[model samples]
Target chain A: MKAACVENGLVLVRELPDPEPGKGQALVRTHSCGLCASDAHFISGGQNVIDLSRKMGGPYAALHYERAFVPGHEFVGEVLDYGPDSRRSVKTGRRVTSVPIMRQGGTHAVVGFSHECPGGCGELMLLDEDFLLEIPEGLPDDHAAMIEPLAVGLEHARRGRPEKGDAALVLGCGAIGLGVIAGLAMMGVGPIVAADFYADRRDLALKAGAHIAIDPRETDPYGPLPDFGGRRVNLIYENVGVPGMLQRIVEAAPFDGRIVMGGYCMEQEALFVFAAQNKRLNIQFAGGEEPQDMDLALRSIADGRLDVTPWLGGRVGLGGVADAIANLSGPGTPVRTVVDPRLL
Target chain B: MKAACVENGLVLVRELPDPEPGKGQALVRTHSCGLCASDAHFISGGQNVIDLSRKMGGPYAALHYERAFVPGHEFVGEVLDYGPDSRRSVKTGRRVTSVPIMRQGGTHAVVGFSHECPGGCGELMLLDEDFLLEIPEGLPDDHAAMIEPLAVGLEHARRGRPEKGDAALVLGCGAIGLGVIAGLAMMGVGPIVAADFYADRRDLALKAGAHIAIDPRETDPYGPLPDFGGRRVNLIYENVGVPGMLQRIVEAAPFDGRIVMGGYCMEQEALFVFAAQNKRLNIQFAGGEEPQDMDLALRSIADGRLDVTPWLGGRVGLGGVADAIANLSGPGTPVRTVVDPRLL
Candidate 1:
């Protein structure tokens, strides 16, 4: 069992041969993983149009260029064995925290996310023992390998149903825009801000709370915007899919605004549609992330209303998965780094 | 008080001197008016870049050539007079309706749509009677000249929340795309279809309740769309604003779809961001009309939900405003027609 592969434009640390679980599955084993800038934009063809209508076993994009597979899908695995009639009772090993949105021989899903269909990192992940969750003996396996990017910044702040104290923004500081400004400052929202043409992802989006951190190549993301005091963000979340970030978040929204998006840019460029129709904008996009946003994000990380430890920077070992893809293909690295896969 | 003036592109009727009401205002008097294609797209410059975000209004982009100014704004008037403490009142000749959203005495409220904002219309229409809406007396000045495209298809089916039986699609068969299939068939939505490239606006959108029209100059509006009875169109609406109809309503949506957009087109298009991120579209855009969507569209046309009499056809005064703007400027003029600005 060794794994960590990619091959051709290289990554490899391979081995293989290990299979087991069947009826309803549950094999698992990793215990740590998370690299995402969408796995360095799908190994750098800048997100080569994925959406194989959910094909499971393959180094997708037509055999990840003629073979070599395994890359990682955000994890914290454990199980080790299950199978037969499985209504879910993983036992051979226990201590879980999975999701790699399975398909490569099934289970431990949560890769790109799911409503009920995917997850399970690498080094073997056959989950379906009800998509395993278990991990709470006082949370820590590096915070369950950071609950899949804080469940993708709690599914992009649960699409602007934000209230209790609103104000947010977070354009693109990577790792899901600093996990959506640490899940909109743990759902209470605040001066948030975050943008990023990159000043080290705006100093790690001001240690993940972001009370300000601009730099759209230093100012002028269509002027103004960056305030916070007299709050005027009512949520924007867009993780830079850069089509001029949909006309700069509809010219930095506010008047009845919402946005959401969640990066993966390709281009269609501008769209003001009269400033998203005179600021009566809603613009949603990041859909599908259920289990009720991971059970209200593990009850907002056990009631501290989330913290995602300032986007935790370093943690390697899957034989440094090719030095975590050359420190996440440098743009000044450091955004969300974490991976163990039992140290390859 | 005469009016009818597009100058140089001719259509004269001149005179002038009447406009009174001031301070919060109210003068009204037009009584029935509807000649929009945004006034033949501002006498055919086709809403010239909404004259730079003024959401269209003004005598612009060259041609006004000397003596011109008095374009219409979609009327159905009456109040007849008021000036003091005027914040609106159902007095002196009552029956009202005005949305002429225009401001910028951008050179004397260019006459029609009774300039609701600018010096707010003249030869008399000072109205801000906090945006008037009383049209009731047995509804028919051709259904109060369809309260401005039925309050813009009731604000595009209330910003396309469309559900109670959705199967909409209504692209564009003029008169604001069959008044958005008569307000998505008064919200009981059904097999509505109605594409149009014009065979008399697809026979006036199959006489308005359009259960299928198509025609896109014979077909293929990015194919696949036709069937509404095996269910498809979970709402399209677009109202033909020309520049690639928001990329053919995102290559014909359906997978969590809803387009809406009211249309006016000018160049600024390209939107497929991964097929609107795997068909999760919402898109919306009405562009104007929101006084509680003309008071729930005059209480859904005084509660019978709505009926534009098979998209009316003819009825004029003010001396058939230049042969009703040359028979509603070509191809199929029977989609809607109304004018009696008190016969000028």
Candidate 2:
């Protein structure tokens, strides 16, 4: 089976032994796998993703994403075979995506970040049957690849609890930001304001349903009320985990606002605590989504309410993943770039 | 009538004409009034209480707190007379405490902060009958005066949603902090740890039901988990509102901790937002409480489950309020200073 393997600091496609299905697991043939920022983090040299995972001090502490680990978690695949003692949740050849949790020595290890099991960045991978969810009809392979990321957005939007007519500000135009916009749009939350540094990402945000997209370089988002059309932002989604973005959004929130933080900031960032205290805001941190959230994301995409194909910058095969990751790391890179393992 | 008035940055009891009950209002003889920090803010006069109120922008924007207004909001009194068109919620001579919102020419005004109606800092005060809550039989006068502040703590505790086995941390030992301790005690949340800069305040916190009281000046509160007895802090109540206090608490909190910010910080303060984001914390700011919360506070006090009498530093007459506020503002002062208008 062809898989993208990391050697030293570079990722390249190589023929690896096919992963076998363990108990309560199913063998899956990969369809489409999305390249994520975390994948870039693992591939880059300075900081090791496995060491950071251990530093987080969770079940991840014992788990390992070793030097040669496969890199993708957001991927769609088909059930190929079931292991002994499996529940047989789905038939062979069923189109599916799954929550990637592997039990290791009485603890759970996240699939893509675990060294014991290869992730969907390969032609063949093994997944827990209980974590599987069938992709619905009318959703393409590109959009199906987005089910995991979109579920992240849905979970964050659920945490914010945005109501109709409440003004919202999303302070990033990355993949997570686009997913949040799609979730908010499905919920009928209006007048969504989005901010981004890049014009292309800003356009993608608008396509995802942002009413107004501001390039922060040109305008002052923290100037005053008139900057946001005199409307008090009751809900804020901070997708930019940078230093000043959270502080700026907190300044624009009104009394009793809700701020959902979805961005993964690897470094410590400073914010004005007094500002958040004054508004009496509810600040919630969003990490990942539950199974129900994944179901909702798939349903919304199948119903045509969420269209993320525009977010897909390009498609590649396992052999092209390395270049795609390199290109995506540069400035003016596309929102999402995917790889199909079956392609030559 | 004797009333305490703020004139040119001084609060002294002065003889004034007896105030009469207006339409839909009642005249009450004050029993006990608590000296709050806002009173000090009003007397110091960098910004007047009304300006701050208006800046908050609610009913206070249209309501006026004239320069000579009396300053006490947490008080218990007996109804002396009823004005025309007053609803017969309680009879004359009924022991009650009101929420203190009075409509003045189509706009509502807060009682202690409103110039139009004298507060309980005086011998007599005008209260809207609609704002009144009858004191239960078993609750004493001093404890009844705490109903409002206790309600604040109850609201914050409710927002934090601490279960039975959850370890809690309180970051201040002020009057509000003691009230929060009492609320947490009533909810049966154990191993409550409290920190205070003042030794006297720490003593009061322990008396109020904190299992452990740490003087923050003697030890580094943010050092490591062993400093807090190697227990995870799942719930934190931030009542200090000072610079670096909230940040330290966020650092000490365990995974998915709930932090309730109850104190009001007047200036901007810096915090580590990444620490909070990584923990996936739910940070809620507690302001005013609901009617149900107020009822719960009173009920908790009436049933002898929550007692805050130890938090009272000392008692003073109307004329002594100025010196009391000044002394309480300084170090080595008691937690709460109450004023009994009947005393000389």
Instruction: State which candidate has the highest DockQ.
Output: 2
lDDT of each: 0.62, 0.75
Candidate 2 lDDT by residue in tens digits, B1-344: 88887665777788888889878888899999888775675454424323444544444454333357777888888889989887867887878887756777756676777667777788898888777899976677777888877777777777777887788888887777887887787788877888887888778778878888887778644334464467655788998755576666665677788889887654445554545665678888776566777788788778777667666667889889888877765467766688888876
Model 2 agreement with the true structure over A1-344: per-residue lDDT tens digits: 88987655688788888888989888999999888776665455314334444554454454433456676888898899999988889989888897767765666766676656777788988888888999876567878988888887888877788887688878887888888888888788877878888888889889889888888788654333464567655788987655566666665667778889887654445554545654677888885777888898888788777777777878898888888877764456767899899996
Among all windows of 10 consecutive residues in model 1 chain B, the one with the lowest summed lDDT is: B113-122
Distance from true location, Cα of A28 in model 1, Å? 5.5
lDDT of 1 by residue, B157-240 (tens): 667787776777777777777767766776667777888766777776676567778776676443454353355666777776
DockQ of each: 0.10, 0.25
For model 2 chain A, where is the 10-residue window of minimal lDDT?
A: A44-53
Backbone clashes in model 2, listed as residue pairs = none
> Candidate 2: DockQ?
0.25
Query: How many steric overlaps does candidate 1 have?
Result: 35
**Model 1 lDDT, residue A262, Cα:** 71
